[model samples]
Target: MLIYSILFPILAIIAIIVFFFRFRSGKLSLSSFFIWSIIWIFVIIFSIFPDSSMVFARVFGITRGLDFIIITAVVLLFYLGVKLYYKLDKLEDDVNKIVKEVAISNEISLDDEEEK
Candidate 1:
């Protein structure tokens, strides 16, 4: 067993525990928790059985396991990046809407005719 085989699983386990607590505390959404869990679980699997990637690579028609892993990582990253970008845009819009509503509700009257 390589050093990484033991080390990566340990780190992955720690991350899973930390995220589980965060999810329980309502800091993470169900989907977010599950996504992170899946990612970490894959890390643990791959670290423990490095040869398993070759099977996955064969399925994907990739000649090398490392290439397959890299491609998958890039694709996953792009997907996640797009997801986060959309969420950020939605949050920005929500904040702007709330601010506008608050401003309108708390409007100040400075008209001279109205003050008279």
Candidate 2:
């Protein structure tokens, strides 16, 4: 009950903020709300379940729910880190391509000037 009381309001606030931002940007979509609602529902259900932590630990083969939560969080963070790294790599490649094109054009212009 305590967990639900703390988490439900936080999730609700997050959903509201996300919806507000999307609406303000004129890109509001149903899918985002749907996902958020699903997550909130799952969290609420999990919070209500007695021995939820023990269930999670048994399912995950972890000693405790806290350990399972820590492991899940670490995995999520690593995944995000890898995703951001790839995005940055792609951006760097794009910038390098543009720089190379500009350099080539500048060199050609210099040659033309020298010829004249």
Tell me, what's the RMSD of every candidate?
A: 2.3, 4.2
- How well does candidate 1 match the true structure in TM-score terms? 0.85
Where's the lowest-lDDT run of ten residues in candidate 1? 105-114
Residue-wise C-alpha lDDT for candidate 2, range 1-116, written one tens digit per residue: 58666777677668767776886687866775666566555555455663575677788789877676568668867987997999999999999999999999999999999999
- Candidate 1: list runs displaced more than 4 Å: 108-116
TM-score of every prediction relative to native: 0.85, 0.63
lDDT of 1 by residue, 1-116 (tens): 89999999999999999999999999999999999999999889989998888999999999988788899999999999999999999999999999998876666543544678
lDDT of each: 0.92, 0.74
